[model samples]
Target: MMAPNNHFATLGLSIGADENQIKKAYRTLAKKWHPDKNHEAGAKEKFQEIAASYEYLSSKDRREMLERELRKPAAPAPPKAPQSTPQT
Candidate 1:
């Protein structure tokens, strides 16, 4: 079974991806996995999921939410250790 967040995972992108990225990823995945192209039983479902994900992300409200989520500050990186002195 696909996960609740399968759309994000399938597209290999963050939830807040812009319309252009969403369209690009959808086109790529749709072409690769479309039921018309693939004979697999689940190909249709996969394509539908990708389409739905694109549609939702394309919506203005959802897009804003996604952008807000992505805009959170990233955790600070750990400090690097000091380098040892070089010998002459």
Candidate 2:
């Protein structure tokens, strides 16, 4: 799954955007990329992605989940093993 930030980026919004901002961005993007209005290549796919992002961000529960995820500290990276030298 794409990171939460990517969803916000898809709609040209920051993670801090409010519901009204999300709706406005979705409306603008939907009108611009709606397949019926835009015959250009990839319009349908773009519209789909925009719609999905809007839906994901619109739900209060999902938004709360996202906030919780953001609050958690990032997991530590796995330690790298020592490199072995090849014998000639």
Best by TM-score: 2
User: Which portions of model 1 miss their true places by more than 4 Å?
Assistant: 1-6, 67-88
**The 10-residue segment with the lowest total lDDT in model 2:** 1-10
- The candidate 1 region of ten consecutive residues with least summed lDDT is 1-10
lDDT tens digits by residue: candidate 1, 1-88 = 2224435556768766667887899899989889889989889988888888877776888767656655666667799999999999
lDDT of 1 at 33: 86
Q: Distance from true position, residue 9, model 1, in Å? A: 2.8
Global local distance difference test of model 1: 0.75
Clashing pairs in 1: none
Q: Per-prediction TM-score, please?
A: 0.62, 0.77
Cα RMSD to the true fold for all candidates: 7.1, 2.7
- Return the top candidate by lDDT: 2
The runs of at least 3 residues in candidate 2 whose Cα sits more than 4 Å from the true structure, single-residue gaps closed, are 1-5, 86-88
